[model samples]
Target: MPERIRFLRERAAMQERARLLDGLVERERSRLESLAQGNASAAMPLLDLYSDSALSEAAGLPLPSILGAPADSRAVDDRWAAARFCMSLLRGRKDLYARFPYALSEAADKNTFLAWLQSDEGARSTGLTPASQMHVVGLFSGDFAARARQAFLADARIRQVLPHGLTPAGQHGLFGWFMQHVWSETETHLRREEVLWLFMQAAENPRMELARAYEFTPDWQRRFPDALTVFGWPEFASWFVRHYGADPRWVDVAVAPEWHEPALQLRIGYGARGAWSTKYPLALSDVGQARALIGWLGSPEGDAGLSATARQWCQALDLPAVASELLKPGVNIIGHFCYPSGLRVSVESIAEALGQAGVDTSLRDLRTDAKDDPHHVDFGGPEVHDITVIHTQPDPFFPESYARSDLAERTPRTYRIAYWYWEFDSIPDAWVDCAKQVDEVWTATEFIARGLRERLPIPVRTLFPGVRLTPFEVRKRSDFGLDEDRYTFLFTFHMMSVMERKNPLGLIRAFRDAFRKDDKVSLVLKTSFGDRHPAELQKLRDAAADSNITVIDQVFSPDEVLSLMNACDAYVSLHRSEGLGLTMAEAMLMGKPVIATNFSGNVDFMDDGNSLLVPYELVKLGKPIPPYDADLEWAAPSVEHAAQLMRRVYDDQAWAREIGARAKASAEANLSLEAAGRRIRARLEEIEALRRQGR
Candidate 1:
C-alpha cells in the first residue's frame, strides 16, 4: 500500500516537471522573437526568466518534474533544458543585432515595397552553408547496392562514400525514398561540405538584407541521375525565395511537396550534368547575345576597406552565430583569376606571360572533363603555385579529346586551381587525378570552400572568383541627343534573344515611381531580353509609359558604356547575385554613384557610404511555370523602393555628387584592376616562398 502511494506521487511529479520545461521553451522562444524585433520590453523579462531557469537547471533542482525523482539521472531532461537555453538565446533580438549589426537598414534606402523586414537587415556575416539544409537523401534510397553493381558507376567510386540507408528490399521497393531522407542538401552545396564553408556563404547572402522565402526539393533517388543531387541549386533557390522573392517560381520548384515514389531517378544516368550547368556568375551573363567585347582594363581601388536566407533552410540550417570580424579581413584576398578558358592562352603562353611579369608561376592543365575524350582540355606549362586557376563555367568544347592529351601528366607540384560555383560534388574525373599533384583549391567563395571539405576527399580554401574591370567606352550625351547638364540616371534593363537576370521590370517600376514624384531626374537604360518573356518586357514598357526614359536594348562597346556611365549622374545594377558584381564595381570606378541589390560577389564591393545599398523584398508568383516547378515568393529591394533611393539621390544633387566622388575613390583604392593584377603577382611569389618553406 505504501509503495503504491509513493509510485503515484512520483508519476505526478514527472508530469509537473514536463509542464515546467515546456513553459521554459515557450518563454525562451518569445524572448528571442521579441529581441529580433528590437522589442526590449517583451524580451527583457523573458531574458531574465530564462537566466533564472538556466541557473536553476544548472543546479539540477526545481528541475521539471518530468525528469523524475532522480533529477540528475534523466538523459532526456537535459535535451529539453538545453533546447530551452540555446533556442531562446538564438531568438534574442539584441543578440541578433549584436551578431548581425549590419543587417539593419531603412526601408526608403531599399526602394521597393517588397523590402519589409530586410529594410532593417544589411550586409552582415552570411554564407552558403549558413542557409543550407542538410537533407540526407542518398542513404535511404534502396537501390544503392544495385547501382554499385553497375559497370558504368563502379569506376566513379561514389557508392563507397555516400551517407545514407535504404529499405530492406535492397532498393527494389522504393528507390531514393523521400522518407529515406538522411540530411538536407539545402544546408550546403550539393557537394559534401564542412560547416565553415557553408557558414561563409550564408554569412555573405544575408548581409545584404534581401528577402527570399524557402523551398524544398523532393526527389526519388534511383541509382542514376535523380540520385545525383546538387545541394547548391536548392540552397540558391531557397535564398532567392528569402532574399529576392521578386519572382515566384522558386518556391514551387524548391519547396518540395510530400515525397512520392521514384520521381527523379535519371540524374546520373544521363552522365555528367555539367553540360546543363548554369554560368558561374549566373546573374551577369545573358544567354544568346553576343557581347561586344570591351578592351580597357580597369584600375584598382585605393586603401580604405571594411567589413561585410533561406528557408526553413534559414531555420533548419541556422549556422551558429558567426563572428562578424571573420567576414572583415585586415587585407582581403583580391586578384585576377585566369580561368582555364580560351585555347589562345596555352599553358606555355601562360608561362611566358608569368615570366614576363617577373613572377615564377608553374602550370598544369587537366582535361576539363573526362566524360568526352574529344573535348578533353589539358593545361600544362608554367605551373603556378598559390594563385587559383579560374576554371570558367564548364565548356562542352573543352579540349580533352586528343589522344595526345596529357594535361594531368604535365601538372606541376605545389600549384592549385579553384572549382567554379557549380563544380562541387561532380568534379571531372581528370581533375580528381590532378588534385593529388596540386596543393589547394579556392572553391568559389570561402563558403563553398568549407562546404566542399565535407563532400570532397581533398582540401579546399575559400578563394572567391572576381570579375575584371577596364574602362568602358564613354558614350557622350550627344550620342543620345540628351542635355549633358541634366542629372541623368543610367539604367540598364532590357530583353533580347538571350535571358539575363537583370530585372527590367524592376528598373521600369523604380524609374516610373521616382520620376512621377520628382521631375528633375531622367533615365537612360541599356536593355535587352528574350522572346519568351514578352509579358515581362511589355509590362516593363507599360510602367514607363509616363516617364522620360530612354531604353536601348543593344550591345554597346565598353568604351561607349563607360563614357555613358561616367556622363550619367549615377548608375544602378540591381541584380540578385552576379556571383561577383562587376558592373557595379566598374561603375563605382568610373565615379558614378551606384545602387545594387545585395547578393553574390557584388556584396564584396558595396559598403557603408561608398554607394547606396538596397534591401531585397520577397515577391510571389501564383502560377507554376516551365524551368520552375511551382510558384515561389522571394525578397529583395523592390522597384517601388528602388525609386525611393533614386529620389534621394536625384533630389540631393550635391549629396549625389558627393556620393559619386566617394564611389569612385572607394573602387579605385579597393577594387581596381591594377590593384588586383599586383595582388595576383604577389600571390605567386608568396606561394613560391611558402613552397620553399615546405609549407
Candidate 2:
C-alpha cells in the first residue's frame, strides 16, 4: 500500500477506537445513575458489573447514593445486606476505606458486622481471607484512640500472622500488608529476627523480578546499611547479579570482592558501548558505573575481553578529559535541513557563516520526510562533533530527534544548545518547561532573547543569523505574468504561519486604499500551503477581487523566489509579529527598498534611514491562535499610515533608489556572514572559559 493511504487508514482506526471508549464511559455513567436512584436489591446486580479500574478514570462517575444511604433497620437480613454493600464499595475506593470506621460507628448493627468481619464464612463471601485480616482490622480501628490502636497491633493473634518471608507467588505477602497498615503505630512491634528473615527472603528470592526487588533494596539499605555483609556477600552478590547485572546501579556492590568476577563477565557480554549500538548505555550516565568501567578496562581480565579502540574510549571517561573534548571548535547543527521553511534558512545561513570563519561545522537533518525541493543544496562535514546546536522550536522538541540522528552516540559528551525563535510577547509554560532540557538558548533577535531570559534560568543570548543570497539571473516582469509597465510591490508568506498574525488582509486593504484597479501599479501576493488552509486562502482571494492585486499561491524553488523578488520594484510585509524577518532582509540585500512594520524582529536591521517603517498599536490577542496563547500581545499595523507610505515610495523614484542603497548597506553591516560568524565564535570562546573556571 502507498504511504498516504496507510496513514489515512491508521487515522480512521484511531478515531473509531476513541468513539468506542467514549461509548463505554457513557454506558458506565448511565448504569451508575440508575444505581444511585434505585433500591438496595436493584443496586446489587448493577454493582457486580462495575469496572473499578476502567470506570474510575478521568471520566469516572461519582460515588453512588448507596454510600450515603440511611442506616439499615434492626432486621438481621437487612443488616447483612448493608454490610456487604459497604464491602463491595471498598474494592477500589481508597477514599471510603479511610473513613470506614465512621461509617461502621453510624451503623446500628456495628457488633453484628464486626463479628461477621472475622468469620470464615464472611471471608469466603467478600474474598478477604485470613491473609488480609490485618488490613480489615486497621480500617475498623481508624476511629480508636491512639492507645487503643497500639494495643490492637500488639495483640498475640496479630503477632502470629506477622509475615516473615515472601509468599509462594513471589509477592511481598503479609509483611507488605503489615508495613502499609500498622508500621507507623509501633515500629517495635516486629521482632528483630522476623525483620531479618523478611529482608533475607527479599534479597534472595529467585522468582522476584528486577522491578519488584528495587522496592525492597532502598528500604533494606536505609534500615541496615551493612545488609550485604549480614546476608553473606557472595550469596547476595550472586542473586543480585542474576537479576540486576545490566542495571547501572550494580555499582552499589562494586566494593565487594565477589562483585569483581561477575562484573567483568557482564561487561564482556555487553561488549563496547558505542554509537553503533541501538540502546543508549545507562552506565555512562551514572558516575560510579562510569568510573568503575574505566578502572576495569585497565585491568588484565578486562584487557582480554575488549579491543584496543574500545579500551581507549572507555579510559576517556574521566571528567576532565570529557570536558576538554567538549571545548573543541567543531559543531553539529541539527534541524530540518532539507525543508523549505524559515528554520531551514536560518540553519543554512548559520552553517555558512561558521564555515567562512574557519570553524568546523556539520549539518544533521532531523526530518526524514522533507518535501522534495529541486533547489536543495547539501552542506557536508564530519558526522559527529563536540557541540550540537538544535534549531527546532521548543513546543515540538523531542530528545528522540537527537537519538535518531548520527549525533546520539556523542550526545553524552556534547554541549547542547537550543537555537529557538518565538513571535509572541510571552511563551507557553509547557514550551518553557521543554526549553529547560538544554544547557543554554540562543535566539536570532533581542525580542526573543528578552522573553526567554525572563522565563529561562539558563543562559539566553541574542545572535543574529547571517543572510547571504546566491546571485540569480533576473527575470523580466512579463515572464512572471506581471504587467511590464506597472510598478509592482511584492509580499510573500506561508499559510501555515497563522493568517491572523501575517495580516495579509490588512495589507490588501492598505494596497486598495493606495491605488485603484485602473492605476499603473500592482500588488503581487506570493504564498503557499493554501491547499491545507482553503478557508483562509478563499478569504484572501475574495478580498483581492476586482483589484490590481494578483495572488500566486504555488511552491517555488529558492532561485525562482529570489528572481521573483528581483523582478519587482519593492518588498513589503505588514506582519503583526516575526521571530526574525528573513525575506525582508533578503530583499534589502538585493538593494530593494523594503516597507515593513516598525515592530518585532525586523526592527533589528530596519530603520527610518533605510526602510519605510509603518507605525502600529500593540493589542491583546483576544482569541488564541494555536501555538500562541490568547493573553499574549502582538502588533496591529495602521493601514492608513501604510497606504500613505506606499504612495510616497511609488511617486518619488529617485528617493526610493537612495533608500534602497541605504537598506543594502545596513543589511551588509549587521546581517552579513562575517558579522554572524564573529558573534558565534566569541560566545563559544566565553563558554569554554566558563568551563575552565568550573562555574
Candidate 3:
C-alpha cells in the first residue's frame, strides 16, 4: 500500500509537468502564427517564453516558405503578404536569420528575395533597423564568389541611394564589398563625390589593392585640382610614386602652395629608416621622392619648412645654407627604442646623457616587431648623424639588422660604437667577431668590459648609461589592485628576457616560504611577454596561488614603471644573472630597498651597505638556455637567504628606509645624467681628436 501511494504521487507530478509543458507549447505555437501573420507586436512576447535556439527552430520552416517559394505560384497580393510576414519575423528576432532554410544558390529563390529586397516596401522594412539590414547582407557569405554577387547587388543599390546619402549600414556594406571587389568592376556612373569617396576609402584601407583605383586619379585631379589637400599629399605621393614611378606632375602637386606646408612637415619629420633626428631623409628606394622634396625645398617654397629662428640665423638661407644645416654632424643612438627591454632604457639613457653634454643626439628605433608598450615615449631626433651607437646583442648587430643600405650610404664617416651587455663570464666567439665591425665597444659594467677587453684587440670601455626617473604620476598600491595595508615586495621582469635567467618561479617559492596567506606582506610579480612562455608562467601562477601574491602580465610605460617601483616598499630580483639590472637600479633610484642576488652587472652598484645582498652559489648551467650555454656558469641565489631578507625588510621599516636613502645617494652619484654626460663627452672628444689626426 505504501509503495503504491509513492508511485501514484510520482505519476501525478509527471502528469502536472507534462500539462505545463503542453500549455507552453500551445502559447509558443500561437506566437509563431501571429509572427507568420505579420503581427510582430504579438510575437515579441514569445522570445521570453522560448530560448533563441528554440524560437529559431520553430520559425525556420515558415520564413523560407514565405520568402523562398516559387514566384509563379503566388499572386502579387499573396507575395506582398509573404514579404510582410518575413519582415515581421525578421523584426521579432533578427539574429536568428543568419541561416536561411532555402538554398540561396537556387535562381528562383534568389530572384524572389532580390526582387522584394530592391522594392520600396522592402527598403522601408529593412531601413527600420540596422540589425535587419545587416542580417539581410549577412545571408551572403564574404567568400570571393559571394563577394562578387554582393558587389553587383550593392552597385545597383548604391546607384539608387547616391542621389541622397548612404545610411551607416549601407556605407558599411558598400565599404566591405569594395574592399573585396575592384572599384573599376562597378558599372555605376562615377560622380566627383563618388570618385573622391572611392579614392579615400581605397587609400585608407591597408588591405585594399590601391593600384586598382589609380585610373580614377586623373579624373579626381581634373575635377578637384587641390584634391591632394583632401587626401593628404604625403600619403598620396607615397602611393603615387609607388605605382606611377616618380612622376613630376605629382611632385609639383605635392609642393603646390595649398599642399606645400604638409609636405614640408613630412620632410622635417623623422624618415622611414627610424632615424628620429634627420630632416628630409627617406628609405633608399624613396630617394626619388626625397630628391624631389629636396629640389622643392631648395626653391623659393623652402622657407616654409624652416622655423623663424632658423630663418633669422641663416638670413633667408638659400640652397647652400639649407645644405650646410642638413649636413651637420650629430650622434645617432640606434637601438630597439620602441621595445620594453633593458636595451631600450640603455639607449634612452645614453641619448639623454649625450644631449646633456651638449652633443646633438638623434634616436633611431630599429625594432620592426609589435611594440611591447604602445604608450612608450618617442624621442625624436635628426635624419643624419656622424657617430652610430648600435646598442644590441652581437648576433643581430650586423649591417643587415641595424645598417640598411640607406643608413650605410648616409653614414660613410660614422664612428661606429657597439654598446653591448652580457651576463656570462666568457664571451662567445661570434660576439668577438662581430665586435671587430665597431670602432670600440661600450659596456655599462666593468664585469662585461673585462671580458670584452680580454677577448678583443679593440678598445672596450666601461661607460654606465645614465639612470633618470621622471614618473608620470605617483601611483598608489590601489591603482595596481594591490592591498594598500600590506607591505608589498615587487619583482618586475620580461619573460622574453628568458624565464630561467629571471627565475620568477624561484621568487614565487621564496615569497611563499617567507609568508602565510594571511600575512600582512604581499608580493607583486609585474612582468610582460608571458604569453610566449605559457608553461613557465603557469608554473609560477600555480606556485603563488595559495599566497598573498599577484602576477601582472602587462606592459607599462617608462614613467609608469618608475611609479610602480615607487609604490612598492621593497624590490626583489632572484635572477641567475643580469646584463645591467636596469629595473633594480630604477628601484634603487626611487629610494626603495632592493633585495637582489649579489652577482653579475648589478653588483657594480649594489653593495652590502646600500641594499640587501642575498648570497648565491656559482653553478654551471646543466642544460642550454639559448644565449647562455650549458657550460656557462651563473649565480644560483639562495631562496632561504632571500626569504629571510624579505621578512627582515618587512619587520625593519626604519632600517629599510636608511638602506633606501643610502641606495638613492649611491645611484645618484654613480648613475646620474651629469656623471654619464661627462664620461661620454670626454670619450667623444678623444674620438674626435683621433679622427682629426687621420687615424
Model 3, which residues run further than 4 Å from truth?
1-250, 253-315, 318-329, 372-383, 397-399, 403-413
In model 3, the Cα lDDT at residue 271 comes to 31
Instruction: Please say which candidate is ahead in TM-score: 1 or 2.
Output: 2
TM-score, prediction 3: 0.58
- Sort by TM-score, top down from the best: 3, 2, 1
Give a tens-digit lDDT track for model 2, residues 1-695. 69999999989976875575455345434533544554222221111213433222311323331122322212213322333334454434545435442334433346445556567866665555453544445444433222222222223233222211232221223223333332322345432222222333233322332322222232322332222321223334444433222222532333333212222322322332342122324332344544444556545465334444435444555544443333336567877676667787888889889888766676766543324331111322223444678888865645555532323234244577899889965677876677767789999998888888888888888998799997787899898899999999999988878888888999999999998778799999999879979999999999999899999998776788899999999998999999899999999998999999999999988899999999999998888888787888999999999999898889987888888999999898889989899889888767755754662
Point out where model 1 deviates above 4 Å.
Answer: 1-388, 395-416, 419-440, 443-474, 481-485, 493-500, 517-520, 528-546, 618-635, 682-695
Q: Candidate 1 overall Cα lDDT vs. reference?
A: 0.39
RMSD of each: 28.8, 24.3, 19.6
Q: Per-residue alpha-carbon lDDT of model 3 for 10-67, expressed as tens digits?
A: 8997687557445544554564455456554542221111133432342232333212
lDDT (C-alpha) at residue 128 in model 1: 10
Best candidate, TM-score-wise?
3
lDDT of each: 0.39, 0.61, 0.59
Candidate 3 lDDT score relative to the true structure: 0.59
lDDT of 1 by residue, 492-516 (tens): 5334211225565566677776776
